[model samples]
Target: MVIIKYYKGVESNLYNYKAMQAEIKNIDLELNELKNEYNGCSSISYEEKAAPTNKFNSSVENEMIDRRLKPEQLKIKKHKLEVQLQKIDNALETLSEDEMHLVELRYFKKLQFKVIAERIDRNEMYCVCLKSKIIKKLIPLIFLLDK
Candidate 1:
């Protein structure tokens, strides 16, 4: 496939795949905490006021609303992360075993090119070229950058 345009931040997104997975785990923990915080609490409450006015709300009330919405926000974030993860996963699935290993060594393990070359039994130049090709291949798969 031909790449018409090099999408900005594709390299960074590829490099940060492992970090993104870790973030998803953290989000899960946060969502659990939020859920536990509101467990057994009344979902409905009644408040009496002198007049039925909705013009303004107290800071406390606003904070409470924000807190209540926290889990939904977190869920949205988690879903985004999951989608990115799925894209990366699908891209990885398309790679050959050697390509996958190169990606794991270079990106997931954060290895230097020299080290990766040594590990993969290839010359440094070959490793560099292969890495470039892999990134190009993945850009289309991961980002759907092909037109």
Candidate 2:
């Protein structure tokens, strides 16, 4: 099997991680908004107890039903986000020191391979080889696929 690994681009990956986190936060905010809307509807119905009509109760019931459904959906989303977070953490852990430094220089510092190699007192080709290996290591760790 041709194991095509796209390694050494840690900046984009880290940015992707941050984007995922932002998405998770956005999801949380959406869930909270839904809950708050439900609560407002529910409380208003209760507050209007003296009004004699089935309309208020029915509206409140609809709001409650929505509240019930939303939480279940949010729970599923939260679980998926948690799994993604775990994968990112695992990828970070699996990196060797050299591999990690290479990634840091390449991604965080925005250094070219030649510059990175010069700073580290190595050839650019050496960085390329190491980066390829690092990418291979990261792929399985991030995807949780069979190696």
Candidate 3:
């Protein structure tokens, strides 16, 4: 048995975007969970009567600030990922139809070469060779997109 793993063009960026999306979802879930914890804790006072309410209020204020920061950070990260995905899409648009189809199947749709060959009615070796050529053509396009 043998295994070969390859990803080209915007494949990595797409994977990263997916991962960041999952992270954002997790952060959102955490924030929702924290909301319940926050409500529950609000009923109790810290350090009892001797501690001024100002101290308790400040602590709660600080906690709120910390809680807000996570979602804001995740939002920024998600936006950046979206920008990268957009750039990838623009680069993809410049390719010839055949090349674009190959790239889409390989990268965007994450299809194996054998499956792609079957779908496209070509031999696997031909598909492999064509993908190499497609990647060569995309190199300059990808660079241009970065500008």
- Strongest candidate by lDDT: 1
TM-score for every candidate vs. truth?
0.77, 0.59, 0.59
Candidate RMSDs in order: 5.3, 6.5, 6.8
lDDT of 1 by residue, 23-136 (tens): 999999998886666434333334534466775554456557867888889989999999988988988898899988988898788999999999989999998888788877
Tens digits of lDDT, candidate 3, 17-53: 4565566577677767766765323544554555555
**lDDT value, candidate 3, whole model:** 0.65
Off by over 4 Å in 1: 1-8, 38-60
Model-by-model lDDT, in order? 0.78, 0.73, 0.65
TM-score of the candidate numbered 2? 0.59
- State, as a TM-score between 0 and 1, how close model 3 is to the true structure: 0.59
Report the Cα lDDT for residue 15, model 1: 82
Q: Superpose all Cα atoms of candidate 1 onto the true structure and report the RMSD in Å to 1 decimal.
A: 5.3
Q: Model 2, which residues run further than 4 Å from truth?
A: 5-15, 39-68, 105-123
